[model samples]
Target: MNFAKGLILCGAIVAASANAQLRFEISGVGSTQIPVAVASFADEAIAPAIVSNVIKADLERSGVFKVIDAGRVISETSAVDYNEWKARGARALVVGSVSKLADGRYDVRYKLLDAVNSGELSSMGQSTAARYTRLAAHKIADDIYEKLTGVRGAFATRIAYVNENRANRLYKLEVADADGEGTQVAVTSNEPIISPSWSPDGTKVAYVSFEQKKPIIYVQDLVTGGRRVVVNQKGNNSAPAWSPDGSKLAVALSRDNHTQIYVVNADGSGLRRVSNSAGIDTEPQFSSDGQYIYFTSDRSGGPQIYRMPATGGNATRVTFNGNYNTSPRVSSDGKTLAWVSLRNGDYGLYAMDLATGQELRLADNATEPSFSPNGKYIMYATEAGRRKTLAVVSVDGRVKQRLTTNAGTIREPNWGPFMK
Candidate 1:
């Protein structure tokens, strides 16, 4: 935490070995719930799990669809029974099939049928390696979601987070699916790791590691396990935020005096301090347009969110309602801003509509809000009973889901971009 303000946020971080799989417990229904029936895919038993089941889970977790039982195995080639599906209380029916090829790839096909209208809404085919069965299902879900709701789905994206196991004295940075599966350890260290920011292209991650007994920023490639130090000045370095183009990074460096925001090239060169504030200025996040950089600063007697030119000039405060607001994050469309605000002694996730200046609180006791690729949901670390878990709330403050794990502490969650 760059100049900690007595707030700690934890997400759905998994541990090593047997504790890798993250579990989710979603609750609350949206105002409008379209009932969708997903049929069992033929030959999908060869997949990691049932491909149709994964599709059902993805749609259900979005809080936009209520899963209805299809009651039998149905493939994309099956004859349409729109009236039958409508009798089953399903507004839409999803049928898919999966076949394993001789070359060790799976061919998955799906069609979204409008039961009420008795017509086909959408159809798609995805071929993937045997290992990416879940990913294939996610893509199908994304297509179905977009066809029905007119908003791009974020189910196919990935999420990265920091896991600190104080009991075993282990620290790890891990990446997983947005729904918390397919775990991959990016980097591990006995020292702490925090503030993971995904590259705009979803190929790399920029984070702060304390392996050298001091904070330093490092940009690590997700595909290859190679990494290079982006910032390691005389003092502490933390809170690395990637630019929209992925060419440069805005981070907090304490080399000058108090922790201040600076821009640096991804290759660890062309470092220049951007914010010239006597008060600590940190947590620099670039806007979606790359025209401005939003950050947190205490220049106004207390920490408040601010925005300045991407190259840094006069900082204008963006947050006015709260006296303490930090961890500023803008949506992918650049129309919404999400940040952590301290209210009633609880740090919570708050979002503001940039066009109308309207604000709404998302989740209480939450911090570190990261907008999904489509900007439809905000993922953040929040308190769940006695343990810390991750929760995803829709930007409209309607749908909510709680993602939990069996053990370990979770922190610093970052949602990845759309790979397609």
Candidate 2:
């Protein structure tokens, strides 16, 4: 498939703002929910309500903050009445302002305050295009979250998924913000598109597109909408996994008649076999350190996750608790392993501590799990009632949120890397 020409011919670059906004359902709540009050910004001409709404929704959906209703509006530049907020049981308060700039842009300024201590936590200012108001709001939320929690926030990241319109036999590869906003279709085709994987730098995506009546891997530039077929051999070529440094890809190829693991350069040259197993070896993911490659194989009689040296060596079994385990994803810190496991006749998501070997079950009836860039949550695709929806769970399994769209079936979600 000539991916560049195919994307142009199919008209896949769809406007995200034209589609339906994703609706979020909070399934589980955390035990300690911090009460936060976000005051309305000062300016009404720049649509400050839209910015505040996005910030409130982001913190609320994370299950970490309870957005309290600020009874009266407060000016962003005015001093905050800490005693009033403390009486309302709010621990933290967020106040901001939006102003129309002289150069046809918007200036957003925000402050994070500690209500209990009556002190200022942090403050920031940003200037952005009027069209990117929501994105600017998300950046403010990320800053507030990091200041309060001491962990880097992932609110500024993005996610990629496949939206299949079975009725028209059309598939669209879409990208959206982490909160399911700013949806943009990158590519579209009549054939199936699956396994959307983001590049380490968040500029490109590698995915399997069956446009030529067979599985072929393509890497597309997200900025220019230009794409090239990286792996198009005679037989099945699928599951393109990016290495840590973004110089090479680990893919599964059946050109030799049996699916095996192979490492290929980013430009699709110097292909070298990594696994010599007879059983299917696929879904290869490189560790954060790039020292080992983790993959799923049935060489042990049943599908299980195995790890081999990045330079190719003996494979060692990593998952032993179940007969079936696949889609292994390592955390950014390289201390945890998350995968899909079948236990008690039910398939669920599991995470294991690499050092202690202790495992924890995250969710039941979940598939295609992808960890957030900060390793705080795991997003997966599952069936809600009869419709397929996307859900996210905290790593500790304490909080959960489900995201559903009014569009057709949604599947194969891959959380993008952190924004630069």
Candidate 3:
């Protein structure tokens, strides 16, 4: 049996080991890349390898500057010979040092230098517990990203997902640091948990749970482990997507005898119908501006994505190429949408421009794709035989990586915003 089919029958299956490692590398294809070289910390540094690689990865992922391979670095400190670096075509240089405190904590200090003029650009430092060394590195990356791109970096965020281990009959809702470390099970249950969407505040996650033997929407608080059912109507109360303000949720409900879009307050009050067609109008997602809600509907024919004003306006069709499109996730800026589009007899992750309606495929055999809080990368579900895993793809559709643990089959990854 197919792995996905077995997953439904067995209600969560152990997946095989993933064949990939999640790492960052940039080939620097474009001519517009700012040439930057990051050198490994001195051998005396405390978190030597971790900090250097994390900074390199963060810079490469930013898509603004090209990270020069360190294979040609002439120095790794503020005393770098600018002439040598300039000879190698490096425009910017980064050097850092890490120190382990007496309490076993770690402090990372780094400086940016303008290679051309050989002048100090900026200097910063961050401290973290020994366990959060990776987070400290991400923080450094966030600082660099903001300084360069002027947009806040999401390197310090987290991702939550549901994992199923068929052999052990185990199901767990897992949360991990955005860089895929510090994983802990948020909830463990025999029933399935699906559709984990983060609240705008990054404090809560709204998902569907089958713990009551029926589908119900649940909002789970991360810090306190407090949870309550948001909506548990008679049928198909699935896909709880929070609006931008965290005040309203656009959900799909079948309590009216057909699946339709419904908007209700976060407290479950002011329940109002938003879609009234004779079709399945589900998977409702609110635009970042909150002026409109985009959803999956089949009123025209097979399922296609549509957008309607948040206050209820005439619906507008957004997708025309695929026979099926679902799981629409709008970016934080509301300019792009990442979704699953079935084309050429295969389901792949795609992004569509809302203004021009131009669509681009991001990944193959990918579904249920969710965008990163910063809208730079997308995490989606991919299956091969009995193995299901989460795959992360660059928003520009260039880089891809797969993540899986020996513990279970991973599915339904939802990226959360950077926690303040």
Candidate 4:
């Protein structure tokens, strides 16, 4: 639980570039989408539609906003044209400008206005490197979203996932923006790589990599691209899940001849067993309060979700609707539990309210569901046609988005923590 140990490990990992950019398509949208219009920036000729387009796309993909045509919106910085926007059916309007600074940076300023009231809601400015124009745009979109929706925006966050290119016989660990843009490979090898759990601070990820000829758990620092083997025990070291405090990881290991949940320090010290079961117990995730660990086990003759103390003790089963359930992930508030459940031979993602015990099925044929930092959406890998792709569904099951890659299969997506 030492911060210094995580820092030391951070300095030892190396960073790498990603291989492909993930393309996203809105497979489904919310029934009631707020109509919003994004006007072209003042200096559009400088970057054309880069910033405005990215902002528009981000909002639209959330399944909560319907982006109006930019051609009909005025790009002026002066008074608001309430009648014009209202005629276009836009409830909210966003206007911004992008200017180049003397230091080679860009000044991106934006304003969120209530079109109906002809009033300014919020305005902010940011300066970023010329190369990070798109990221700067995402940040602005996030700001606008929060100002309008009263929910923290997740647009500025990143995602880590494993890509398997069977044609090239390569397995890659990749990171990209929440919109699936600017993808960069974090690690690549001929063997398989999976899990990919992000650290609490969003700077590091712990995943199971088979590059060493066995299931080995590695903690990779995203900033430095440096990596260290956190668990290289004899049998199998896999399924690494970071604790909420980022000081320890709950992992499933079979070094002792059976797969059981164990807790290990961030620096790979103080390893202790957390789950004791004769059958396989794996995929341990810590609750937001850091008091209980949720996991999947077959000790009761079938795979189901279970919970126990973080320090290891008596276990309690949580799921009762289905005989097969696994990959339990607790929400940010620890009020909801999301996991994969098998129904009629089809695997689907389901969320359960811990307090009410009411269950809601989110998506069918989905696996590896991880909640967004704000607990609004759950991202998981699902099948798209003949290939596997990444998808996201709102916690309410009203909004859905699918991210498809041009080549290879995508799996094991872990949404990162919110950006600082």
TM match of model 4 to true structure = 0.93
lDDT of 4 by residue, 81-170 (tens): 788889999998888888888997888888888889988888888888876888888888888788878888899899999878878777
* Per-prediction TM-score: 0.95, 0.95, 0.86, 0.93
Query: Residue 241: error of model 3 in Å?
Result: 0.7
Cα deviation of 321, candidate 4, in Å: 0.9
lDDT of 3: 0.76
What is the per-residue lDDT of model 2 for residues 1-420, given as tens digits with 9 covering 90 to 100?
Answer: 011002323333556654555667887777788899988777734653377778888898888888986755555678877999999999998887888889988988888889999999998898888878888888988987898888788998999998888888878888888998778888888888988999999999999988888889999888877788889887888888899889999998988898888999999899999989878988999999999999999999989999999889899999999898988999888988999998897779999999998999999988888999988899998888787778899988989989988888888889999889
Model 2 misplaced stretches (Cα beyond 4 Å): 1-12, 17-19
What candidate 1 gets wrong by more than 4 Å, as runs, is 1-18
Q: Considering summed lDDT, which 10 consecutive residues are worst modelled in model 1?
A: 5-14
| 79 Cα displacement, candidate 3 (Å) | 2.9
Query: In candidate 2, how many Å is residue 414 off?
Result: 0.2
Candidates in descending TM-score order: 1, 2, 4, 3
* Of 1 and 3, the candidate ranking higher by lDDT: 1
lDDT of each: 0.86, 0.85, 0.76, 0.84
Q: Order of candidates by lDDT, top first?
A: 1, 2, 4, 3
> Pick by lDDT: which candidate is best?
1
